[model samples]
Target: MRRARRTSGKAQRREVRRLAAASADPALHFLLLLPLALLHLSGRAHADLAAYGLVEALLRRLGPAAGWLLAAGLMAGLLWAIGRIRRRRLAWRGGLLLAAFEGVLWGLLLGPLLQLCLRLVSLPVAPLSVPGSAGALHGILAVAAGAGLYEELLFRAALLSACAALFARLPGLRGRDRLLSLGLAVLVTAALFSAAHALGDPQALEGPVFVYRFLAGGLLGVLYLARGLAVVAYAHATYDAVVMLWSSPA
Candidate 1:
C-alpha cells in the first residue's frame, strides 16, 4: 500500500509538470482559440459583426457547408504549422484545463488591477454595459469569447510575430538590439490593439476609456510574452465575461 501510494504521488507530480509546460505551447493556444473563432464566425454574435464582416461576407460567398469546410481546413493547417514550427507534441486535455484555471485567476486579478490603475491616473472607472435580455446576454458572452480568441490571435500572435520578424531583418541588429526590437514589436502591437477598438466604436476613444484600453492592451501583451498566448487569451475572455456579468441589469 505504501509503495502504491508513493508511485501514485510521483505520477501525479509528473502529470502536473507536463500540463504546466504544455500550457505554454503556442500550438495549444491555436487549438483553444479555433473553436471560439468558429463560433464567432458562425454569425451568432452582434459584437464582432462589423469587425468580422469580411469573414462573414466570405462565408456567404462560399455558402455554409463549403465555408465551414474551408475554415476547418485552414484551422487544421494552422495547427499543423504551429506544431511543426515549435516541434512539440501536445498535451491537449491537460493544457486546456490549465488554460481555464489561468484565465480565471487572471480575471480575478484584472479587476482590482484596473481599478488601481484608474485610481492612480485619477480617472473615474466606468462600469462596462451589457444588455439584460437573455438573448443579448448570450450574444455578449459569445462576443467576449470571440474577443478573447481572435484579438489575441491577431494582435499578439499574428501582429507581434510579424513585427518581430520584420525587426529581426534589420541590418546590424544583434544581442541586446534584437531584444530591444522584440520589445518594440510588443509595444507597437499593443498600441495597434488599443487603436483597433476605436476603429469600430469611436465612442470607445472618448474620456479615459482609450487610456484604459491602451493600458489593458499593454498588460495583455506583456502577459502574452511571459505566459504564452493561451493564458492571455483566456484571461482576456474571462475578464470580459466577469465585467459583462457584473454590468448586466438584474
Candidate 2:
C-alpha cells in the first residue's frame, strides 16, 4: 500500500507539470480558441469584418472548395508546427479556468483602468451601441465574441509572429537586441490594429478615439506577449461584452 501511494503521487506530480507547461503553449492556445473561431465564422459577426475581409475575398475569388482546401492546409500546417514544438498532452480544464480568470481580470481591472485614464485625458469614451431588441442584442454579442477570437488571431498570432520573424533576420540582434525587436514588433502591430479600425469608417477616426484605440491596442499587445493568446483573447471578449452589455449607450 505504501509503495502504491508513492507511485501514484509521482504520477500526479508529473501530470501537474505537464499541465502547467501545456497551459502556456501557443499550439494549445490555437486549439482552445478554435471552437470560438468557428462560432464567429458561422455567426457572420460584423465586429471581425476587417479581420476576415482578406480571407473572405480570397474565398470568393478561389471558390468554396479551393478556399476550404487552402484554409485546411493552413490549419494543418499550424497544427503540425504546434505538435513539433509542444508534444505533451494539453490540460484543457486548467486552460479553461485560466481563460476565465483572465477574462474577469480584464473586465474588472485592466479595462476599467484604461477607461479611467481616457476620462482623465479628457477623451470621452463612447459606449458601444447596444440594440434594444433581443435579436439585435444576440447579434451584437456574437460580433463581440467574434472580435475576441479573430482579432487576437490576426493581431497577436499572425502579425506578431510575422513581425518577430522579420526582426529575427536583423544582423547583430541577440539577447537584448531580440527583446528590443519584440518590443518594436508589438508597437508596430498595435499601431496597425488601431489603424485597421479606422479603415472601416474614416469618420470614426477622431483624435480621441484614435488615441484611445492605440493605447488599448498597446495594452492588449503587451498582455498577449505576457499571458499568451488564449488569456488575452478571452480577456478582449470579456472586456467588450461587459462594455456593451452594461455600459450606457453612445
Candidate 3:
C-alpha cells in the first residue's frame, strides 16, 4: 500500500508539472479559446475574425446548422495544426480555471495602473470606445474578445518574435545584447500595435489615444513574454470588457 501510494503521488506530481507547462503555452491558448469559435456562430454575439472572412461565403451558402459545424471544424483544425507545430497537449479544466483567474487578476490590476500613469502625465484617460464600431454592449465585448485573441496572435506571438529575430540581425544589435534587441523589438511592436487603431478609423489617431494604446500595448507585449498568450489575451479582453461596460449608456 505504501509503495502504491508513492507511485500515485509521483504520477500526480508529473501530471501537475505537465499541466503547468501546457497552461503557459500559446498553442494551448487557442484550444482554451476554441469555444469562442462555436459561440460566434450563433450569429447573435458577433466577433471580428480573419478566418470568418475566409469562411464567409460558406456561411452565406449553407444552412445555419451546417455552417456552424463546418466553421467550427475549420477553426478546430487550424488550432490543432498549430498545437502540433508547438507540441502542446490538451490540458483543459485546470488550465482554463487558472487562465480565467489570471485574466481577472491581471486585467483589473494592469488596466487601472495604466490609467494612473496616464493621469500622472495628464494624458486624457477615458473609458473605452474600444477600437469603436462594435455597437451595443455584446458587440463591444465580442470585439474585445476578438482583439484579445487575434491581436495577441498577430502582434505578440507573430510580430514580437519576428521583430526579435530582425533586431538580432541588425548592425549594432547583432552582438551579445539580447536585452537591447528585446527592448527595441518590444518598442517597435508596441508602436505598431498602438498605431493599428488608425486602421479601424483614421480619426482615432489622437495624441492621447495613441499614448494610451502604446502603453497598453507595451504592457501586453511584456506580459506575453512573461506569462504567455492565454494570460495576456484574457487580461486584455477582460480589461476591454470592463472599459466597454463602464463606458456604455445605462
Number of the top lDDT candidate: 3
Tell me the lDDT of candidate 2.
0.69
What are the lDDT scores of the predictions, listed in order?
A: 0.72, 0.69, 0.73
Model 2 bad stretches (over 4 Å): 1-18, 45-48, 70-87, 119-135, 171-176, 247-250
- Local lDDT at 122 for model 1: 98
lDDT of 1: 0.72
lDDT of 1 by residue, 1-250 (tens): 9999999999999988888878776667667666667655453645553435545576688876876787688868786857653576557678877876886698678778877888998998854322222246666667676777767877887889898888877775554467777787888887787677765666666767767776787788878888888788788877877887776676
Question: How many steric overlaps are in each model, in order?
Answer: 0, 0, 0
The residue ranges of model 3 lying beyond 4 angstroms of the native Cα positions read 1-19, 40-91, 132-137
Lowest-scoring 10 consecutive residues by lDDT in candidate 1?
126-135
- Total colliding residue pairs, candidate 1: 0
Among these predictions, the greatest TM-score belongs to 1
Please write out the lDDT profile of model 2 over residues 1-250, one tens digit for every residue: 9999999999999987776676676666766676556655556744446666666686788876876787798679677746745465567567556655765587457567777878888888753222222145565556666777778889988998799778877776654467788888888897888777876657446776667776777778888888788878877777776766665355
**Candidates ranked, most accurate by TM-score first:** 1, 2, 3
Candidate 3 residues 5-80, lDDT tens each?
9999999999888777667755556665655433344333456554244356556677678757876886777767
The positional error of residue 44 in candidate 3, measured at the CA in angstroms, is 7.1
